[model samples]
Target: MTGLLAFTVLVALVGLERVAELVVSVRNAAWSKARGGIESGQGHFPFMVVLHTGLLVGALVEAWVRRPDVAPVLAWSMLALVLASQALRWWCIASLGRRWNTRVIVVPGLPPVVSGPYRLVRHPNYVAVVVEGVALPLVHAAWTTALVFTVLNAGLLAVRIRAEDAALETLPRSTEVEHA
Candidate 1:
């Protein structure tokens, strides 16, 4: 019973985080659009939203139905991962600033961001997302949710990353022209 309540609270917190992200995404989307941003991979965006929403809902439902015993070791490790993923996600958002949007909107003249986590991984935000997809459910012993979301998110990301790369293909050339 106590575990169930705790898991419920965790889901609520994650939902809140999703709300906050949406606020940022909306603001950033507007900023990008005002600057002639061209959106790419529009079709996959809806699936991404559904997948994230399903993660939150599925975690709660799975925990309630399965009521699996939580191993302290697993829980602790997953908690660490969840925290790390959140930090990385926010870092990506801050690094991109007004240029960040939930959609892949490429503003032709803007330079690609190579700072923050992006310095190491081209898609650091997606890395955080993948980590969170697994960690969040495992924290509550929802292995099924974690596995399903990870697999589905993987497919979506394959499409998303390709679109993003195509959108940013000319960034280097544009940057060079500006500096020349």
Candidate 2:
């Protein structure tokens, strides 16, 4: 099979993984709502969805239309990063469990999660997101998609993180110390 074909399969797999995430997010959102969760950043949610969907579509379109010659070394390395991002994303989901939602919904009085990947970074999932945003498109030499996604995602994340931080402030402070 051609490299483009392989990359297409990879993108399709990632898209399917996204569908699974939505399933989990919906269920978890219900769980959080049951516990008096308050959602913030609703205004940017539609943009977020469109941007993410565009990532996949743009990558594929660029790969097909541009038909750039894929460098094996870059392809392999980026593929590794893409896989690592997916692993990190799932680790975040596991760490947050039912507390995790695509939307910024925080339950009142519940302490912020400081376990798993959260111990390392306040928003490890976004770390995964940033990495994947660049790496996945590069897997098939779709540099334009990667660049555009990164720029747009950066602006979106700025708004998103601020809203999330504000919402999280509603939660009680954890007494547990974070170890360096």
Candidate that scores best on TM-score: 2
**Candidate 2 has which clashing residue pairs, if any?**
none
lDDT for each residue of candidate 1 in 1-180, tens digit (9 for 90 to 100):
586787789779889988999899998888888888889899998899999999999999999999999998987898899889999999998888878778998776788887777778989999999999999999989999999999999999999999999999966552222211
Candidate 1: global Cα-lDDT?
0.87
User: Model 1: clashing residue pairs?
Assistant: none
lDDT of 2 by residue, 11-99 (tens): 99999999999999999999888988898899999999999999999999999999999889999999999999999999999888888
Task: In angstroms, give how far residue 63 of model 2 lies from its true place.
Answer: 0.1
Cα lDDT listed for each candidate: 0.87, 0.94
lDDT of 2: 0.94
TM-score of 2: 0.97
